[model samples]
Target: MKDASRRVRTEGITGAAVSAVMRDAGLTHGGFYKHFGSKEELLMESLSEAFQEIADRLAQVGEQSKPETAWKAIVKTYLSLEYCDHVEYGCPLPALAPEMARVDKAMKPRIFEELKKYRSRMLPFMPGRRTADKERAFFSIFSTMVGAIEIARMLPEPVMREKVLASARELLLRSF
Candidate 1:
């Protein structure tokens, strides 16, 4: 059950492929139902795990001497080839945000909580004169980071991928 949870958390639980992967790992399809009360249950747990993984990783970017320096570290990390290549092991914002809109209604609140946690994690490093300014920084940083990664992953050419990511990083770092 722990292995299944770990695998589903890293990957996703929306499709047959996910179940198939579990089957390949020696778990029967019916075994999933015995362990999880419902698909939503599995999804919620997986999302939680993914959210924690990101929170832990981002937390490592500890206090920067300056806001811009911190933002640079963040932007570079989010847009790097390392992050893009390791989708399953890294941030789910880029991988799971699109699916969030289409997830089960019962699971929406859990997903929202994960997003709130993510935004809050970023708030301390942003330079804000007011709450609204801080809010803008939150959205700007998240959008840019996720957008850059998603765009980079879509390009067929490796050079274009690097270019797109680098450009997004530059724009985001300068936005504040």
Candidate 2:
């Protein structure tokens, strides 16, 4: 499952070759079904694990620091070039969004549930007095973070990539 998570994040879920996935896992191609019932099932499980891992990391950051400091750390880490360069081991959202959009319809709700939990976990870190205001801020910060990383990763020039990350990080922090 961990191998699949890495593969699907670095390679798209449907784009990754099953044979390569098996090879990475040190198993024969035919051995796949011995573990998962189907490819979709494997993808779902992999995504779930990836999301849970990121959530745990964010939760740990929140627990270890003051809310404002934790929020800054999470944002800085999320927007860092190191995280952008290591999609296979980093957060799955930006890496998988395009592919996840086209995945089996049944898979989406499960992914959405995880996303909801993630946002709820992030809510306390955002600054807003009202629930609705905080919810809006959460979406804005979260979406900007994900979109900035995605756009930064797509840039061919290193300078342009850093500029995007720096700009988005500045804007997000200022908004809060």
Candidate 3:
């Protein structure tokens, strides 16, 4: 499942071949069915796992941080150079959301559910006085972070990528 999560984040769904996935998992390609009914099932389940993994990590950060600094910590961590370079271990949004639109229609709801769950998990860490404020902040912060990461991933130079992350980070830090 970890192998599939990394593959889908870095390679996209269609590129995650059963043979390659099985090979990476140190199992025979023919044994794929012993785990998943189909590649779609594997991909969806892996996506869920990816969301859960990142959310849990961020929740831990939120839990450990003071309320006033929680949002800052989460944003800094999200917009850092390390997170920018490591999509395999990063959020599913910037890593896989684009490809998600191209996935089967039936799977869209499941994807949405995972997204909602992720948002809720991270909600407590956002800096806001009210739930409404936090919810609005959620859309702004996450959308900007996702866009920044996606743009940074496209850049060839580390400096340029850092600029993108920094720009978004600064703007968000001030606004939020």
Query: Of the candidates shown, which would achieve the greatest lDDT relative to the real structure?
Result: 3
Model 3 misplacement above 4 A: 25-27
**Residue 171 alpha-carbon offset, candidate 1, angstroms:** 0.6
Give the worst 10-residue stretch by lDDT in candidate 3: 21-30
lDDT for each residue of candidate 3 in 1-176, tens digit (9 for 90 to 100): 78778877888777777777666666575677887788787788889889988898888887788988898889998999999999899998998877898888988998899989999998888889999999999999999999999999999999999999999999999996
- Model 2: per-residue lDDT, tens digit, 23-73? 766667568888777777777777877887777877777678786577777
Tell me how far the alpha carbon of residue 40 in candidate 2 is from the true structure, in angstroms, after superposition: 0.6
CA RMSD, predictions in order:
3.2, 2.1, 1.4
Please list all clashing residue pairs in model 3, or write none if there are none.
none
Global CA lDDT computed for model 2: 0.81
TM-score on alpha carbons, each prediction: 0.81, 0.87, 0.93
Per-residue CA lDDT of model 1 for 1-176, tens digit only, reads 34443466345566526565456445567877786676677666666767777766766663543654765676677788878876776677777777778877878888888888877887776657787897898787888888888888888887889898888887887777
